[model samples]
Target chain A: MRQNRTAWFFLSPSLIILFIVGLVPFFYILYVGFFDWNAFSLQKGMHYAGLENYRRLVFDQPFINSLLLTFRFAVYAILVQLVIGYVLANLLATDFPGKWFFRVIHTIPLMVAPLAVGATWRLLTIPGFGPVPFYLDRWFDFEYSISANASQAFWTTVIMDVWHWTPFVTLTMLAGLTALPREPLEQALVDGANRLQVFWYVKVPLLRPIILSTVFIRLMDALRTVDEVWMLTGGGPAAATRYTGLYIWRIVFPKTDYGYGSAMSLLTLYFTILISWLLYTAIGQQRRGER
Target chain B: MKKLITLVVLLAVVSGFGLTANAQDDNWWATAAAPYAGVTLHGVSESTPPSNYAADVLAPQFEALTGIKVELEPTSWDQMYDKAIKDMEAGSGIYDFVYIEQDIVFSYLAQDYLVDLTQALVDHPELAAPDFNFDDFTTFIDDFKNAEGHVFGVPMEAFVKIYLYRTDLFGDPEIQAAFEAEYGYPLAPAATHQQHEDIAKFFTEYGEENDLDLWGTTVQAASGHSSSFYEFFESIAPTFGVYNWGINEENWKATVENGGQMNSDAAKEALAWWVSLLQYAPPESTASTWDEVAATFAAGRAAQGWVYGENTAWIASDPDRSQVVGQVGVAIPPLAEGVMEAAEAGTGYVGYYDGGAFGIPHSSKNIEATLLWLQFIGQPSVQPEWAAAGSRIVHDATFDDPLVVEMDAQTNGYYTLLQEQGYLFKGAPAHPFHAQVRSVVEPFIWQAIVGEITAAEALDQAAAAADEEMARLGYGQ
Candidate 1:
């Protein structure tokens, strides 16, 4: 009884904050999704039209297109971040001169805010002013203007995300490497196993849990990404790069369709939760199989 | 420890509320004005010449005359809108007067969020002086007035759509002779839809033949506010005879979908002709915006452009900004055959529509002072002042003034041409659904221009979507 009281006392503040800032507002948004609430006419009583907002989303072409773009962006972002991050992690785990310097430089992109990174990249990609296209044309006899094309926009955003967050994944993996038991790795190395065989058979198997956790966390973070795209193209040339978050902002702020925006937010939240749960379950199953 | 944290959080919240309340009360207009004892008036404007020029020239003059100190707050257009909306919504008396766009007058007036300036006009007759003829103001001002006929604001800057072309490029003897030979007329600024298409085609084909990187014209198809697609559509929608709302003189109900007379054969022909001109525009024109179009023209890449008359001032302000500064000529947008016929039949000239007006927010405590400032700005003396400083003044008397004309001539006759061609004048249909309809039609028009969709397909989709949106908004059947 005494332990239970002590635990409750410690958790009370967090519980209150979670209720006020998170759970309460989230539930409120869900309720708002059932109304026809225009922000411009906030004083007027909202009309209740249950599921109408969802129905509109189901029929809206732009909404569906944005959803597809977001999924594509996420898949590309995860794969690129994982591959680059793992390679960098492996490189850093080696005994090399100037290793600390290289590690520090790798962390530089992560230190800058995503908005600054996006802006810097946008300046670097401008056709006349930027050097990337000019240099590429000189060397490869090819020109690239990603901002003007939809498919290119998707790849550009993915590349930017990889550049910015690969360091984060690398740092996490490095920590996992240091905390890992060295005995098994050393035994495998001494048993006439080659470097690749040792890494693939022993080290990679040990890093599985850490890798899954990092991927899951990064996936969750990437789903709500907005600032980078907002600053770079504002989801344009058309609505080419518009993610669900940008779409929500357009509906809520510019169009003043708060009810519709709420519906979109709820839908995004549901998809994110579902995806995270599936990821967690799959990772758990994989770990069990490995054991 | 928990109690302490809770106490700190509560205190922070309370202090935040207190500070907001205090800040609202501390602003200039909220406090009572010191009568004749040197009152301080707060004014807000964008970083334009008129606003900046007023701060330099007129503020001091007003202060000397009334013993009122005018505090000018200069901001960019985007910042100005954000700050104005925030202050108005909060009922914070930060500004005694604000410069605002005329289109948003409906939103403001509908909310009863502006002071009625009708009494101020009646009381101050001198402000409506020898040259400030209210009768000469555009008929659209009535649309801006409240149900009680209260004039909430005055029209300040007048912007109109005009065609800007490079005289040097078109004046090439060989090209001109060939164009005349082919089209059976001298190739001057296009005066008809057919002529516009022919000229665009000629320039585009010329560039293609020479393997030049230049385009015939730059048509903006960018998404969002200030999209050229909307401007292009507006310029020709009237010529096409398409009323935004169905025209019913007696019943007063919109019947656009029911094949009303307003949606006549003339309107469809006009739209089709305008759509056809997109063929000669740049391939990337569908993604270009107003700024991009302006850049293209300034880069000497485009032979001709359909742009706002205000661009003349923008280009003339900085020599480095334009390659064709002294070489550009202006003309009214082209008309359709039906529009010409209607004009011959004594119908008033139909043209694309635009307006920019000023208003005092309903929450303003200094309504009287704001009205006085509005009237002062619209005075005959001030009209010339604005004109001299390179702003397009709407007052007829200002346009008639010898000094205004001379000032315009000095600026390479840009103002003179703009005034003569009736560039500041507009006659597009006015409906509450103007913004909404533009949002839907702008994108589809862009798609059509880019060859992503056929003109007929674009129109059909636009009309259907517009109809659905109108119905959703309870606008019309």
Candidate 2:
């Protein structure tokens, strides 16, 4: 009982800080979400909105479109990043000349700030001045205008995300691969399995947990992506890239509709939590099956 | 005893000379700001030329004269507004002075976010400087007044968006001959919508045939940005004889069926005309804001464009910033029939008279110090140099200043046009729900710009959305 009291005393400061900084604001926002509020309106203050904000959310086409777009973007980005990262991880597993240099270069994009990456890509893709458009026009006569083409803008954002995060995925998979026991792979090779078969059957299964966790992390991070995409296209080309994060920002900041923004943000938080729980459950179940 | 008396006499004579020196000139700031000396005034403004001048030039001068340090943070337009509004809403007193843009001032006033300068002067006469006279400012200052004619902000800068064209292209004999032969009209500044279209087409083809890196015009048509909405409504729609975002002020409805012109035939026509200009604009036009449009014009990539007047002086005179220096010409925007008449009769306007004013927020901790800073910047003495540097003239006296007259000559009579014809232009309407209505309406405009919807369809949807949003905001029931 004394030891337990000592532990509680030690943890009290963090618990109090968390309550003040984190939980207090969270609960306050949750409370505010049920009211019609504009911070600028001194007279009106916060009216009792009941479930009106939530009801309006169901009919908010922009919000719906943004949520759908973010999901689509996350799925596409994760699938692409996983494939590319796994391939890079596999290639880096082999002993090669100047491997460290290539690895360092590959990891450079990961180290760059998202805003800087977005800015660099913007400089590279600007219509007349940017090298991407200049070279594309010179070589293939293809008109590469992200601002004009919605598909191009969306895909470019995906590509930028891939560039930014593929390194992280690769490193995670590589760590998993290096830690795998050599016995199963050696036995599989001796049992008449080809290299492709060995990789598909042995290496992939061993890396499954790492892959799932990587995907889970990347998925959550991608859903909340705003800075890079904002700097790149500002969720433009007719809201082609207006993901849920950017949409909530538009509501909260520019529109100053705090109630709707809070409600939508809470909905987004719930969605992310649900997704993470599903992934966590799947990983746990897989571990149990392995045992 | 004799030496001590001589020393006292000498000291008295020196003190008398010092007093006379102090009383020689009108140093009102030193006296007015004496009580507030040593107080640091925090301000936030957009990083425009005028605001930069306030921070870089005027702040130091004000500090030197009054011993009150001014810390002005110049930032991007959106960020500035966000920070200022957030600070005021929180009642944090973070910003002693905030840039109240013409469009957003009504919202600030509605929220009681700013300290009333006129009232402050009335309450504390000691804080009012002799050099600071509100009547010295042009009618643009009227936009910053409350319902009772009490001033809220000191007008820092005000300029209209004007039509800018390349004089070289318009004056070249070969190009003029070709344009006449192709379009059956002499090449000059466009005075009508059809003429503007013809000029755009002619210049585009002219560039294509000559293999020149040039387009016909510049368009602020970013498919997902508020700048596009502003361009269409404030600059383009007015030329089509639509005003006040086409919402009927009486009913606060934006649809034609509801007696609002937001979705009227004229506005649709205006949108169609603006969107159609995409082909003639530089490829980057689709991604452009007012900044990029000015850049396009400065690079001599566009033959003619509706450019904000704040960029006029630099684009026409500063060789380092503009390739079209000495070749840029300023003119009125091409208008539809009877639009000019309506503008002249004071019932409507041509293009946006864009500007902002510095106001002490209600939450300011150092209101008196900020008021002194505001009065210091508002004096007619500071207007000439500022106008010369920024191409923004807010005071009536600034128009006749020698420095501005020279700059007017350099910018091809831009100041002359602004002084003579500025009254025809107007700022945004006095709507407290300005941003709320814009947020709802701009997406449809963006959709139209990106070809997801037709002009008619976009405005139809936009008008309906605007009316719905306005009603939700309790503007009209």
Q: Judging by TM-score against the true structure, name the best candidate.
A: 2
lDDT of 2 at A243: 93
The C-alpha local distance difference test score for the whole of candidate 1 amounts to 0.66
Pairs with backbone N, CA or C atoms under 3 Å apart (clashes), candidate 1: B113-B362, B114-B362, B240-B267
Q: lDDT tens string, model 2, B80-168?
A: 98899899988999999999999999998898888889989999898888778999999999999998999999999899999999999
Candidate 2 chain A has its poorest 10 consecutive residues by lDDT at A37-46
How do the predictions measure up, each by TM-score? 0.79, 0.96
lDDT of 2 at B270: 99
Per-residue lDDT of candidate 1, residues B1-477 (tens digit):
999999999999999998986455333222222343276778676655556767777777666555567777877544566567657766797877776655556656655566667766577553333334455564545645777777777776665666778777787899899889988999888877678788888888888898765667767654323354455555556555454333332322333454433334554465566656556765445445555666667666777767655555555444677776566766666665566556445353445444455677766666666555565566666777676664466676777788777656544566666566553345444454444444545555555543456666666666666666555655554
True contacts kept of each: 0.04, 0.58
